[model samples]
Target chain A: MDNNGFASYFRFSNVDWNNMWSATWETVWMTLVSIIVVAILGALLGLLLFETNGSSSWGARILNWVVAAFVNIFRSIPFIILIVLLLPATQAIMGTIIGPKAALPSLIISAAPFYARLVEIAFHEIDHGVIEAAQSMGATRTQIIGKVLLPESMPALVSGITVTSISLIGYTAMAGAIGAGGLGNLAYLDGFQANNNAVTLVATVIIVLIVFICQFIGDILVKRIDKR
Target chain B: MIEFKDVSKTFNAKEGQVHAVEDVNLNIPDGKIYGIVGYSGAGKSTLIRMLNGLEFPTTGSVTINGTEISGLSGKALRNQRLKIGMIFQHFNLLWSRTVIENIEFPLEIAKVPKKQRVEKAQHLAELVGLAGRENAYPSELSGGQKQRVGIARALANDPEILLSDEATSALDPQTTDEVLDLLLSINKQLNLTVVVITHEMHVIRKICDQVAVLDAGKIVEQGPVLDVFKRPQQTITKRFVNQETGSSNLDDTTVVVSELLTKYSNGVIVKLTFHGDQAKLPIVSEMLRQFPDVDLSIIEGSIHQTQEGALGSLYIQLIAEQQDNINGALEYLKTMRVEVEVIKRG
Candidate 1:
């Protein structure tokens, strides 16, 4: 602690790097699992919402109203409140509510409808003419959905997925609120509770790196699938 | 053959109901180039669209080739649609696909085998003179080429009837004529019945064997092309024909028939409408030579090439007298099928 080397007092990266590596891996795992669930469940919910419009059908009207209320309720609750409210449910589902796995249910709940609505909007934007052309060619309803309408709307869906994946990266860091061991927990506990500025600095750098990688990969996937 | 029995279409608009096509009945003969011409909002497009089962009439029956298409629903309707090919004004070829792929789309829908479809698509491409441009996307082709691709795609199924809903309306004059000529050739070579609907009389004059003038959702006038052009019954049809005939002064271009009869008081003033190679006939010269007292002065005439042949009309003064037995001789000329417009007497 000589006055001449006092600047090293705040020099955090000078510490051991193993803690940082572990925290980085936890954030990557949480983000990957969350995005996969959102992509699948969201696509299904999105398609249901589109097909079950109320104007043409009374049966669909009641179903759409119920589904719509459910989506809005989950989507309206703040992410932090959602995680706290779901502790019992998450504990029962995962057999424990404190690890990286317990956080999965709430992460999916908060993000699924958001991404699903994005998928819905992507589908609604397709040109009506393309669908008419397909029907005119004697395409069955299933064939029109599988061949023409889906392919024409692929670019918008791909772009929606890019946005959804990047947002999930942010949601994973916030998952540390539930004792999930990601960079957020490391920064919140080992740095703030231990009064160790050095540990905080390392966690901060790793989180930034994770965000950058998520964006880079998502950009490449989006560009590849974007036909238009 | 096609027939519309009391067809009517009304769209539910905010202003109440919109009657696009009224109680319209029309009979189109098989193997004839029939045309429906009308201004926008006159329902010419909506009227022709019903022929292919595209627009269902509110209260009427449409029979094509003796099959009632009005009652057909879903797959049956589409199956009927496949037998009737349609071309659009914008040439709506799929922009993402290549020229050959667009042509093969309908064939694929029909489940034609892949190998045979490829061969048929190649033959159609050559027919449209785009043999080497098969791989070109619609964005890579010109307006005319895009329309040719549309034509190839429309005829890919080898439909018995081809419906042109303002097909040439989007092309320039030269391209319009080219596409019209191609349609005429297709009609002749395949004997495919074409129903072309447009507002341009030039289209009617150029390719139609049978012409129907539509106005306000009704068939105002319809007949053989030569008869319709020569003696249009409807005011709208007359206006349309006058546009092509350049009859800017049909009222003022009085034959001066009275003056000819008084001056050459010994002669007859006659008007003849010449059509086909009949215009090239020496009938006018022979008529004068057969009656030495008669003198001929041509007033107006122009030859029009129709789907039938070279057709034209002439307004002339035949200076002759009844005393020379010219009236009986002119009666003989009528037997030759030369249309006579007797404007004055001698």
Candidate 2:
């Protein structure tokens, strides 16, 4: 095998180091911002969904229906199409729809609903007897939620957000495809479009590394917090 | 006193209107351990739950210390519940919290100062025999130890009434007794009115001063534990008493009695039931001496001690050369306050 020919095939010349670094940062920034927002939004929605699901009041029934429908509709939408569909809202919220910041609204909207479902499942996994015990202690509804439900279900909630964060990273890559300025954009414009296999290979490897790091941190956090 | 005035709870299920508790009037005096014993689905839980407002009566009212519990709702109901501590069969301790934290939970609900709450919880932990286990999580404890934590948590608020919803049902016999003893001591120490709901007759026989036997949503019999055990009017009441005394094995007793009866063709089999001070008396030996011509042999016997007194039932065979001596022995037992039921004559 000729060494020069192998270099030409694998590591094509003139790769822009600055552009690659900026794109990597953009991917990380988008993922970080989207996940934080998703965690908050998803947790509230999940709690509402769980609390109102079997409630007898008419107001709660309608609220449950509305929240459930919203979660279902948003979660079913593919992340790629969701970015285009959320363009108008993104422009209104972030003042532009061209870069990593613009991808935030679509990324959070698409992923929060998916994460909300996980959050709801995690709350459901809590023993009903534990809830009854809290009630028998004369805990008001708010106290039960604050002092008992949330703390008891913390490990599951952390693991859930971790899973959502990993998916958020993937969504950020998808957002990068349409000029959002992430590794996906670098891979697309410089690697695929310009026929630079080396750039695409490096971007894919970095994204995989980021996912592993996210999962590793999540596992350790869950292990440390989960007494059960 | 906690009074249930014509209290009845009905649940509207898909099947039909199910009466969980029907027309029950019970008065649980302060500083006494009251037990509501019944089989599964006998409304024992519903009856006790009403005392704490966990279940509201469909028709009547529950008055505890002059407060109408049935009419309360929202914050009022929650406040009433705070004064009436309840422990569950499953322990129901927060698995996430350590023993001390679990004990401090109701204090937190009461909004006690952090320092005071910790001190009170510390005292309660040792009171319920969970002193050194304060930092241990519920998962790290054994079944008996978990129940001790539960008892500590229930007493955290220094409640006037402690509702035990089959608290000992999940424990082994030995553990159940230990927990019962702790409850009995707590009832005396704090002078707290304890309302225990359980199907276990041993629980009633162990700690309860007064017992109400519930069957199919109604109180079939209710009285002092010793009195109820001495003369159980209903079949269910008799069954519960027999369960505790191991006399429910009457089938085996009958087989043994028949075998003994055939062997001793001239013996009289008599069942002697004695309660209170009479149980302590050597009535059987005294009767044998009174009728010295008669020979007595023990067949089967059991003694059960209740909160009120001890109840003992003994099955014995009296052999004599003459039937008149057996008859004389039977009459002598009656004068000694021993209830004698002649089982068979040979």
True contacts kept of each: 0.21, 0.66
Angstrom error at residue B260, model 1: 14
Worst 10 residues of 2 chain B by lDDT: B46-55
Query: Using Cα atoms with residue i matched to residue i, what is each candidate's TM-score against the true structure?
Result: 0.81, 0.96
Quality of model 1 by C-alpha lDDT: 0.79
Candidate 1: residue pairs that collide = B267-B320, B268-B320
Highest TM-score: which candidate?
Answer: 2
Model 1: per-residue Cα lDDT over B85-142, one tens digit each:
8888877666557889889988988889999999999999999889999998787898
What are the runs in model 1 whose C-alpha is more than 4 Å off? A1-37, A40-55, A60-77, A85-112, A115-120, A181-228, B245-272, B282-301, B314-346
DockQ of each: 0.27, 0.73
Who wins the DockQ comparison? 2
Residue-by-residue lDDT tens digits, candidate 2, B1-346: 9889888889999999999999998898989999999999999888887887778899989999999998989999888888888889998888889999999999999889999999999999989888788999999999999989988888888899999999988899899999999999999899999999999989998999999999989998998988888889999898888878888788888888898889999988889998888989888878877889999889899887888788889999999999899898899888888899999997
lDDT of 2 at B331: 90
